[model samples]
Target: MTSQSESTEPSSALHDEQAPVKRVRVAAWAADPLTLNGLTQALMGRLDVFVAAGELPADVDVLVVAADRVTSEVMVSMRRAAAQCSAPMVLVTNELDRTRLLGAVECRVVAVLHRSAATEERLISTIDVVAGGGGLLPPNLLGDLLRQVQNLQEEVLTPRGLNTSGLTSREVDVIRLLAEGCDTEEIATRMCYSERTVKNVIYAMTSRFNLRNRPQLVAYAMRTGII
Candidate 1:
């Protein structure tokens, strides 16, 4: 039989391995006290979330705003709040339109949920996703977002000799292949470039955009509908 100490050692290791990650800090605000209080109450007791107080905490991982509608004044406030921190935001609103969505995008709002549809589980999941640097959008909103991106590309970026997504043609090609699971050597061979050249391309793109790695670059590309 195993010694008591030996058995305890494995159990201790397992406990450490299973330890939960740090909870995400959330700051929620709204035009009305009831809305704000309701949001905080809904998120209470969640294992991986901590609601914060005051004007958008500096260390907040996600900022949630409850609003009835997103107007020009709302967009202004969002931009000001966003300027104070780099955290992604989730907008819980009853109204969303193409223009308002675009405005929110400009303010770094990564997720939106209709107040009627914002269940506790869905809200928490969206917060988790945004905190992890992923974006969340309703399926119907996603199509509109893509169309807006395309129109902007056609009307403004194309005339300026820029790709719609701020990526060069070559960078887009490299990232598209990377997204498809091609190794550097395979990509170089296919593109008739040196392996060093392919690596340099990836490094340049990631460095310019502050992406942590190739996978993140691919995710960014996909989120922005570049590939």
Candidate 2:
């Protein structure tokens, strides 16, 4: 004869299997009536639904801000709503400049997209990812971020005679000065190390990162924000 425990196991498992994943509520903040209408139609009659930001329902779990006329006030509004509902925000903008992107990140923006992405499947994917507490970025922005980091290394860090290269501080100094036309002799002199020590540092950086030449070494440093 089967025990009572065995009898309940199947019922519990069935309930667990049939339970619905929590549907995230989304609000659309679009200035364009057509785009907003299309988005409304897309999310209509869904379990997880969309609403206008101005008249968001009490159950909204996420706010999707239209990128038009985005300002400090809009960001403040998103933050307030997020704080109230413990929901994340997805910003839809035409373009994401460095300042806006940085500001969004600071304000806890979960995902950002171009207005043109309003109809793309990936936009929904990004919204889901953000709703689940993951960060999102444009596919091509990482390169620009790396380039900005490299510029910081060259223009700001290098002038102060600092090198943050070779995945370490001291080695970065060795490589940065080396890139700026310093020889082993000068590097050792400025860093107060023996010539052999400086050479060892350079050799280690090149070998570990698989860099081919001095220029390539510097390029790698810029690419990875090591310098």
Candidate 3:
């Protein structure tokens, strides 16, 4: 005969236990040895460390890249590192401007922390966001990012008849016609283009995106919100 209290105590203990949290896998890179050691030490225990001599671990969830200045040389190295690891990056820097901010995007960097303001808690929290497919940037960096997008759109993409989705105006018109079940000759007639020109447009889009057929291209347009 077991006492009711004994039975209840075990049940209470079971209820109190919690599942262990899964830690984010984090790797650190810096232009110099001292900064590298500092970042790795700061992130220890809070994250699962991934380190290798030659390459970043394929399973790393996030990478922290620290630099004194986000200059062209540092950005070049960061770009190479970003190529090696497809994981999102958190950049810690002493200085960053609009041009440098755009360069950071090229390196897959999702978060930017000013070196002066980045405490361990802040850095860890930023890494967690990047690991979760979210990002945080300071107000200044946010402004810079917006400016970069506007400039790129106004100066480059817009002039080329393209939008953020990388689809040109003509491409969008053709895709819209296709989605409306318009055949090539009908699309050409509606758009005042020759049938051969419409065919060339479709072929160009298919080749660019590697889509196999008209149906697939239409599906892609739908998926990408271009039509």
Among all candidates shown, the one with the greatest lDDT? 3
Tally clashing residue pairs in candidate 2.
3
Q: Is candidate 1 or candidate 2 better by lDDT?
A: 1
Instruction: Put down candidate 3 lDDT per residue, 1-227, tens digits, no spaces.
Output: 88765653557668899999989998788888898888888998688876533588888999888889988888878888888889999999998767778888878889999999899999998998899999888898888899889999999999998998888899899999999999989999999999999999999999999999999999998987887
Error of 1 at 42 (Å): 1.4
Candidate RMSDs in Å, in order, are 7.0, 12.0, 3.8
Residue-level lDDT tens digits of model 1 in 86-155:
7898999998778777888888898999999999999999998998899888888889999998898999
Q: What shift in Å separates residue 155 of candidate 3 from its native position after superposition?
A: 1.7
Q: Which residue pairs clash within candidate 2? A: 29-66, 164-226, 165-172
The most accurate candidate by TM-score is 3
TM-score of each: 0.65, 0.48, 0.78
Rank order (by lDDT, best first): 3, 1, 2
Each prediction's total of clashing residue pairs, residues at least 3 apart in sequence or on different chains, is 0, 3, 0
10 residues in a row with least lDDT, candidate 2: 160-169
The pairs that clash in candidate 1 are none
- Predictions in order: lDDT: 0.83, 0.70, 0.88
Q: Tens-digit lDDT track for model 2 on 28-120?
A: 655567767766666554536665656557677666767465676766666666555546777777766675554565456767777776665
